[model samples]
Target chain A: MDINTVNSLSYEDFVQVFGNVVEKCPLISAAVWSRRPFTGLSDIEANIAEFIDSLPRSGQEGILRCHPDLAGKDLQSGTLTRESNEEQSQAGMTALDSVEISRMRHLNSEYKKRFGFPFVICARMNDKEAILRQLSERLTNERETELERAIDEVKKICRLRLYNLVLSDTQNKL
Target chain B: MDINTVNSLSYEDFVQVFGNVVEKCPLISAAVWSRRPFTGLSDIEANIAEFIDSLPRSGQEGILRCHPDLAGKDLQSGTLTRESNEEQSQAGMTALDSVEISRMRHLNSEYKKRFGFPFVICARMNDKEAILRQLSERLTNERETELERAIDEVKKICRLRLYNLVLSDTQNKL
Candidate 1:
């Protein structure tokens, strides 16, 4: 995980890391998992660049697939990984906040009905209000447009996540 | 612009590139730009990671700012060196069709009225229909939420652009 080690990872090894994460997170997986191996880090990087480039065309369905349904209060709270849960809490949607919990439920229901999937945003950086606002605004969009926007959003999330994965590996090695 | 050259770039060098872009396109100047020198590539990578981590709570507005007004197609287009123009065009959206061009102009007006800035998406990968779809759908969100989403989107665009900048430098050197 050292910077050198990360930089040195074979394309297969790098793809495996991405595959493992994608296998668990289909949204991200869909965005990147399907791509073929690159010749080198630069090639991998270019693939990423092209993938990011393609996001806007895929639309809302693409975006929503990347997120989990909002946390339900009665639902098992511990289902998410520790890292994901911690990230959720950092964004202030703690499991115990009844108001937020209920709102998330309602929003999730409306969003699913409208878009046919969970309301997805890169939740790592969003707060409840922002999420709500996006949900409300996006609902009004025609399905096709929303789908494209959502996909674009999802790609951004993936890119950020990919950067974090590499950075974390580097930090751990240090 | 080798990897070493990119890695060796002083913070001042990054600022110069960023400032040039910002001077040419003022909308993005409000957002902070930083490149930590000597963190190695990993440290530089971490700087980007932390910057993304610190983005605004909402996703909509943040996403919006990273984009220039669609009508201001000339901003990025005009500023790019000939090689960069070819690169941007290859990603699509350079010569928007007539209907799409008008829609961009129309959306440009409506978006500014709705949110005080032109509708911004990382338009590099999106065609006219996809862009229009997002514009219409995102218009429904409450202002506050839209703002955050926009900011989040912008950060993603910035990171992608940065990666391209770095990778391109590396490729050029090779």
Candidate 2:
């Protein structure tokens, strides 16, 4: 759909379509619906980011917590939201071997223990190697720094999702 | 959580926990947040049912469309939403052998072709034998009757989900 079409959506339709642009956090999209007449997809992205920035630490962590871990049990169990599953699969997360899977699980658990949220990178932006390297590197950062970095990655994921919704070559069947 | 705890949730937390009570239709939970301070779980369920009944036919169909097909590709590939995956598995959908799977796929597609939505049953309320019987029986139903039947099933599914959220012996960690 075009920006004009997006601009014309009712609150329900907009939320139904763009709701998962921020992973499982539809509340972000539902809240952003009030800021409508978005000039374009970027305007929508900006509004989403602004909302995320305005949240308290707990709320922001809730957003990160909403994300399924890369190569985690959700992936194994096939319960990742569609957006997350595709992104992880594209990043070769679905191809990880036994050792890599165990290592990722250990790292993911440790990271959550430290930060109280999952290690969320934009899986569409990084391959599995880059994701593994970053996971290890970021585990050493201060909590505040990691929080900012993780939310930035969320925006990247959000941007791509917005593109898929607003700039798709064909109409979104959803 | 108890009804008191449930009644105390902010719009975001309420949606986060009870959102999937209607499957992919978090918009329902988002909308229902306006009607909060629910007297108890049954009141919450009543409000949900009322909100659903208030929808136009198209909107009602939209709710049915949000459900995944029983024993379809989502189940086969492990991509069903967590609630749906579990419900389907419990109904023995996950255990369907090759022939049962093929028969289900045929009936599911045919149902969708006729009704413009997947055949939705409360999988937790039916075993495979009953589901198969109902699918065939319901397919012969008129469009309006089928729509009502399908939506009634959605409510049954929704009721169990509400119980899971509100009446669980332990506090919901979500």
Candidate 3:
């Protein structure tokens, strides 16, 4: 979307457009959308600033909601857009050797059994080996601590997404 | 504990010590812990590496367990260990600004009413304002997505806690 068009979009329309990007990642979309009224926000920085300023208290939780479970490969690819999925695969898991993949699967099961949820991590910028190493290490964390750590990772993911959104918007303008 | 002490500790002991830190911030702790047996690793790089590695998974449902809806400000303060209190505080309502605090209370009520759990986030490393911003933005997400996000956030928190433990150990060694 063009800067002018994005800036001029009605709140609902804006939601519809950007919301699609965020649909699979609803928390991210809501985070971006909740902070709205992008008028005079031609540049990405201004848009982010406005978006941040416009965020509602209730929406933070929504932003936090969209993260996927760590080592869970079953989620619909739509949950992450093509771009994000590609980035994630490239950065975090594409190079996983069979041994690491098996370890990840075993850890994933154990983690889920203990915590009742899949392990979750923000996989945007990390490489495969680093993620595999993490999977092995975090297995020892008690349920109480591991759960909270996952959420913090989600926050980082949101921030990274926001940055990516702005960067993409800038690229689109160019 | 010192590196020698940490080295001497069994995996269970390591989990006990590092697990406490993971409870505070899982992503950070997990990231750090994954790189353990730190004989050759430098301190700062080890910490940074852990932080990088502790990100949440790409796409999966997350855990969601909130602290008690409302407790006396000091109820857990002296009773629990300092670190435990801090971990609770990361989820507790005290640190939020008035608006966010109230909204959290309100939404917490609604969420509890709906899902039988208090609104939870892995709040290590975030300030009241940023947290508030996220809270407001996330309210718009669907219930399922929000639940997933909450769990993801929790995992990230655990990883951070893991990272901290490693750093603390390295410091003790030095």
What residue pairs clash in candidate 2, if any at all?
A78-B78
Whichever of 1 and 3 has more lDDT, that candidate is: 1
Q: Native contacts recovered by candidate 2, as a share?
A: 0.00
DockQ of 3: 0.02
Selected candidate, larger TM-score, 1 vs 2: 2
Q: What is the DockQ ranking, best to worst? A: 2, 3, 1
True contacts kept of 1: 0.00
lDDT of 1: 0.49
Query: What is each candidate's DockQ, to 2 decimals?
Result: 0.01, 0.04, 0.02
Per-residue lDDT of model 1, residues B101-122, tens digit only? 7776787677767765446565
Q: Local error of candidate 2 at B18, Å?
A: 0.4
Model 1 chain B worst lDDT run, 10 consecutive residues: B22-31
All candidates in order of TM-score, best leading: 2, 1, 3
**RMSD in order of candidates:** 22.4, 10.7, 16.5
Off by over 4 Å in 1: A1-12, A20-63, A73-75, A81-83, A169-174, B1-174
Tell me candidate 3's fraction of native contacts, as a decimal between 0 and 1. 0.00
Q: Which of the CAPRI classes, incorrect, acceptable, medium or high, describes model 2?
A: incorrect
